[model samples]
Target: MKGNWLLLIGAYFSAVFYSTAFCVVTLHVDPESHYLEGGKEGTLEIWLEGVQNSEEVFEFTINVSTNNEDVFEITDKVLVVGSIKSKVPYTTHKAGNALISFEQVSGHHDNADNGTIVSDVGDVYAHIYVIRSQPLNVFNIIVGWIYFTAWSMSFYPQLYENITRRSVVGLNFDFLSFNMLGYIVYSIFNVGLYWIPKVQDEYRDEHPGQLIPVKLNDVFFSLHGGLLTAITIGTCFIYERGNQSVSWICRVSISIGLTYILTLAIISSTDKFPNCTWWHFVSWISYIKLIVTVVKYCPQAYMNYSRQSTTGWSIGNVLLDLTGGICSLLQAFLIAYNSDDWPSLIANPVKFGLGILTIIFDAVFMVQHYILYADAHYSKSGRFLSGGGSKKGYKKIHDSEKGSSENSNFFRT
Candidate 1:
């Protein structure tokens, strides 16, 4: 009898270990999201994977619920799940956003729903977006790509100016300093969230049922930005930028931003700060980027104001930035309007606020280039302007600080 009892316990322990190590369940809601106009229809393919075939298994119930019933008309029912998979058809009624949740409430065979029986069955969600119209939805998607392209190309104009002119005089040093640091922090945040397994796990745990916000393009953009920004900074070293050096103000600002960013990273690694995780660290880094964006343009704008000319600055970069800002705002509004989720406009204050700020700065640069300083002539020295805007106490301002000393500079735009 003692040997029989020991043999039974050993079998149970092996089964437990096998189930834990080998059997991993994942609930897949195909497509993850659907976009439709009001009164449209869509089908969702639901499959619960990793459940081994067992003769004793009977059935399971996948309870379906929605955050907003107005958007999708879904009928929740007990799906015997013969093969652990089924199709769920849904219809849209009005313009709104909703998440349809699928959770395994119970299992007839195991009599256990908490995953110890077969595998862990967690909640899966599919998004239903019943927009006001199809055109707006298409517009929103198109605008998203447009802004992405615009922002991505914006860097090239400035890079080309520095490379072709071999001069980075009009390009503010403070702007370069802040921009390089911002991209460095941004690249770290993107890489950590997207590539690091530990950070990915923490992010999934913190925001379950939601797709990881960092995507391949985001990772590419951040890294691309860092690389380009670094190259531009290098140009500042090799180019014919006369007496143009990063100011004290820029150094102090960059030092503080980098210090804070590093502190967060260390806190995440050492776990010195309670509940501060890699997710939290990246989040703080992204926020710091927003702060950086707010100030990064200021230096360039101030420099333009002081110099009374945007001779060294590339207007192509400004125009591209303006296009990106416009498209970004348009896309945000289009999405909000189509889904009737107006409040989502402000949901991500950082992203929205950054867009607004970028537009404002672009407008300033445009005015300086196209209107305010359009008539200003670049002298041989650019070290001195014959007659222009404020000359109060602005002595550091130099004409040699301007772009190409030659009037025939092709990068005037």
Candidate 2:
């Protein structure tokens, strides 16, 4: 027991150390700048440095006016700077040179001594600073893949145990139903936000200089979750225990199907009217997913409480799920740090809350299994505390005519 406790403590610290190291290595801010001549209505050639791809593009904007309130009438101009393949230093003149000229304007300076001071037009120098994005480090990538693998395989142990036992006695169908619907909506939302061009364009416009592209592993993770839930639902149908209500299956299916159809309709409308409509639609779907995830575990927890036993439920699944959830939350933090876009975490509250909620439910399940109902048992000898049944209190019965009975009768001492 002492050794086991030591190992658990060591593992906990190791995880924390590794996550800290990963954040330090991957998250960094490296700002690069260039100076351009700015004055009258003219253009300046801005050199692009460290741009490898000819198709790469950067958002360029010029603020020609002074910071003083006396010169606040100048309007800012925004432009796209694309890489030039033929250039020696790979510049962005082809896309459009920086227009560093602003209209001449005059404004009153609110000074205590001077009642009003008018400012004249002057030459304004522009400093172009680009917020460069660094690709994820190899260690972070490996950790992400590990998280994906753990999440993808989390349900397999429970599925295998159910099959081996040929009973779904301990598993709560309501929980599975909610979980399936949640994953379906989550998968749709992820794909719509990532693959839909309109949504992607809006996201980029709203959040400039931030990289939040959805990876292939993310798609796989959602799909895997949906697939596992579907399998579990099938198993429930096949091996449903005595007198259990399986009628909820049809209701949940129809509701999910209709919701999916409506989601598709909203996504399709984006093609005709392309704008921020898709973003709103996807956001609603994400909220639904979050709410479902938050409530999905309640039914199972209640079931365990009412029955006073955790029999037939696999603890292995809970442990794996806990590990995956912690890793997922850590990965999200790392990404937010790396991109320097902490607001993005709040922008997608569902994704932000999923890992935390999963870990909480998994911990509750562990408590229910190993702590609350540790000695409770459901057996043929009737409901009794584990190790309470005694062979000495049972009498074997024998039949005549060369027949013997394996049944035994139990009596109190």
lDDT for model 2, please: 0.54
Residue 182 of model 2 has an lDDT of 79
Model 2, stretches more than 4 Å misplaced?
1-137, 196-212, 246-276, 333-351, 378-413
Q: Each model's TM-score, in the order given?
A: 0.84, 0.56
**Residue-by-residue lDDT tens digits, candidate 2, 1-413:** 99999999999999876553332111111122232222222224433333333243333333432222221122343222223321112122111122233222221122322111112112223323111122343445667777777878888988987787666666766677778877887787778767888776566566543344676677778888999889977876665343334335435654875676596567757676554366656656666677777777887887677666565567888888888788777777665554344565687676677678889889999988877777654444222223212223322211221111222111101
Question: In candidate 1, which residue pairs clash?
Answer: 382-399, 382-400, 383-399, 383-400, 384-399
For candidate 2, what is the TM-score?
Answer: 0.56
**Stretches of candidate 1 exceeding 4 Å from the true structure:** 1-23, 54-69, 80-84, 110-120, 272-274, 379-413
lDDT of 1 by residue, 2-37 (tens): 999999999999999887556665657677877888
Model 2 — which ten-residue stretch has the worst lDDT? 403-412
lDDT of each: 0.73, 0.54
